[model samples]
Target: MIAIDNILVSDDVVREQFVCDLAKCKGGCCEDGDAGAPLEKGELDEINAIYDIVKPYLTPAGIKEIETRGRYQYDREFGWVTPTIEGKMCAYGYRDEKGVIKCGIEQAYYDGKTSWKKPISCHLYPIKISMTKEGEVVNYEPRETMCRPGCIQGKKLKVPVYVFLKEALIRKYGEDFYGVLEQVAGSYFAKAEKQNK
Candidate 1:
């Protein structure tokens, strides 16, 4: 584990490789999970506030789910999460012509309707975060079956999990923390190189 500021990050973030192969996965993480997209405390209010602007991008089913259940729901195991449509894809999700699910809120953001792109948890996927008495722990757990193609693609492209998640890391921890993480990754890989030689 490497501690930067109040965060303890797993080394696998640098050791392992991953990049979302959307063609293969079809954004399955948004649809396949038992729970909806995890939400931060403030994200709930943000979603509610921006509902009018984002609603246009959503499907009729998504709109009905949001209207009936509200923006987010509480799951005993997962805390607060975005409500799902028929307990499948997230209420904020929509499918493209290719039948791949995508985030409507992000689509709105891309269209310049709102500044908030999407939930942080959705953005920080492949990296799960947990709060401890000591600090926040950022971990990488390879997904079973679903993420295999992404792993293969990442290996082919030579992208480390940390490198792929640069934007989310910076969003979550700030530039200073990410800079320190880069330093740690540099030293860690250099040491590994020496040990191998």
Candidate 2:
């Protein structure tokens, strides 16, 4: 587990243009919940404590997934991903009436209610957690591919960093992580500006 309370985004334009495709992309990562994510030792203990309280609503599968796949720390050699669960959607992933894949934990968090009794990894998406040898924490941006050409081209407009960092980014990674991420995003913006010029 890493203790990255901050991320340093290298570009402002990239950050502004970046809108996570929660509805459109529906990356499988969201479905798995925190169980599909890595955690630090203390973070796990905290999550388990929460799990003990919410065990009833949590599925046996969700618990199993978290236990089996829960990474205590980042394995740089393999990269920051867990082994994909064979042919299974994340325990928290379900289709709505319109047949849209939605995340259960995210819904709960936003609605101010408790979701499954599992690790916090299930709640966070797009933001990845990793640890360095000195135990420094690191967070990675989500990997999203361009979906609609119009959506890709539309991002040429400029907006404030606060929009992404203070709002969406904070909602996902907490204030600490966003602080560092904004720094990284700033650098990205500068480089993008240079390229554009």
Give me the candidate number with maximum lDDT: 1
Number of backbone collisions per candidate: 0, 26
Report the lDDT tens digits of candidate 1 across residue range 1-197: 98876789998998888999999998888888889988889888998889999999999999999899888999998899999988899999999999788999999999999999899998888899988899899999767898898899999998989999999989988898889988998998899899999
lDDT of each: 0.90, 0.46
Over 4 Å off, model 1: none
Residue-level lDDT tens digits of model 2 in 122-190:
433333444455543334344445223223433543434344335545554578766765565577678
Q: What is the TM-score of each predicted model, taking all chains together?
A: 0.97, 0.50
Q: Per-residue lDDT for 97 in model 2?
A: 61
Per the 3 Å backbone cut-off, how many clashing residue pairs does candidate 2 have? 26
lDDT value, residue 146 of candidate 1: 84
RMSD of 1: 1.0
